[model samples]
Target: MSFLPYALAAWLFFVGLYGIVTSRHFVHLVICLGVTQSSTYVLLLAIGYRTGKKAPIFTSGVPVKVGAVDPVVQALTLTDIVVGVTVAALLLALVIEIWKRAGTVDPDELRRNRT
Candidate 1:
């Protein structure tokens, strides 16, 4: 259980990379990009995870302890999620435009259609 997230993250990253490398369509490529990016979130959270630790919120009586999980990584992971979603959305929009103009999303077809 302890090593699960780390292993999953690595597996997800490789799987996404494989998808991107073998992608035929622009949308597929974008989706693979998202999968790859998600692996990083898993990794960041896993790295920041501390067993049996409470959240870092300040309380009147709870003493601050060294065992508290680092909050910075959690924050960074959240920001990464927002940024990644925005970028993926923008990319999908571009793909939609390309499909509208090209009548296809296949990368090879688009390349051949290039004037």
Candidate 2:
């Protein structure tokens, strides 16, 4: 197994984490969170990948004896993507509400303006 995908996933995770930690705006923080979650997709795909295997779709031409990539991993990745998008949408809505109330999207300013 190659280590490139794993390394790439780690790099993406760390970059997103750094962005989250340094984020000032609520929208930016949400975007960074999405970026962090995307690492899981790469990791899952890497884990399920086979060098020459076909997708887990069985057909008349493709016999069951022939190995296929894991379907569970692909399903999980799709689920993760859906959940991430949902969460990002919710967070964006919250940010919009916060901006309407406080006239600012900066987290630091929001904290200062808190009642």
Candidate 3:
């Protein structure tokens, strides 16, 4: 119902994009990418949120007629987080390898040194 969460997600996404655009080091770039990816979690939570609804889990006392939040959204958010962490780890490993070989993590320096 409210637009605040959507606005926050958009703000986070843009901030991350700006950081990525201005980043000089590979590690910093990877961190920015992670930040950008986090916005999706906020967006997903917002979409699944219900003003007065209960969680998707149902118990004996809880009536089936009562509204429940979307479980699929929660699942997707969890999956997204897992994928993001995996991607971040892989990117960080690649950055470490680059640093080991190139002696520098700066993108501009890498470009200059590239054959």
Candidate 4:
């Protein structure tokens, strides 16, 4: 069950990457990034859901013997979210800049400007 989510997320991310790479529209690329991010978040939450573990809050009256989910992964997910947002923001800013400078959002056009 745990591995299923991870596999699905991996597959979804692959599809998103394919779309992003083949996409002719900048909007489609951004949407694919969001899709990839959501799959990763789903995978993270699924991994965190163990069989019968208590909350990870470390309360005073908890008596469960199950191992808590790795807080490192949780923190990583949060950091990933922040980084994803930052990247999307930057991409949007770049798109806006491109539109202002070239009046087009085609990746091919942007690449042509490189040389």
Per-model TM-score on C-alpha atoms: 0.87, 0.91, 0.91, 0.77
Clashes of 2: 0
Comparing 1 and 2 on lDDT, the stronger one: 2
**Minimal lDDT window, size 10, model 1:** 62-71
lDDT for each residue of candidate 2 in 9-94, tens digit (9 for 90 to 100) = 99989999999998999988999998899899999999999988889987788558768998999999999999999999999999
Pick by lDDT: 2 or 4, better one: 2
Candidate 3 structure quality by residue, lDDT tens digits, 9-46? 99999999999999999999999999899899999999
lDDT by residue for model 4 (1-115), tens: 4588888888888999998989877877988998888788878877777766655667679765776766666877898899999999998888788789887898888788879
lDDT of each: 0.91, 0.92, 0.93, 0.81
Question: Which is superior by TM-score, 1 or 4?
Answer: 1
Q: Mind giving the per-residue lDDT tens digits that candidate 1 earns over 7-87?
A: 999999999999999999998899999999989999998898888887767779977876677788899998999999999
Candidate 3, run of 10 with poorest lDDT: 58-67
Q: How should the candidates be ordered by lDDT, best one leading?
A: 3, 2, 1, 4
Off by over 4 Å in 1: 60-67
Model 3: lDDT equals 0.93
The true-versus-predicted C-alpha distance at residue 45 of model 3, in Å, is 1.1
Best candidate, lDDT: 3
**For model 4, what is the error of residue 18's alpha carbon versus the real structure, in angstroms, after optimal superposition?**
0.9
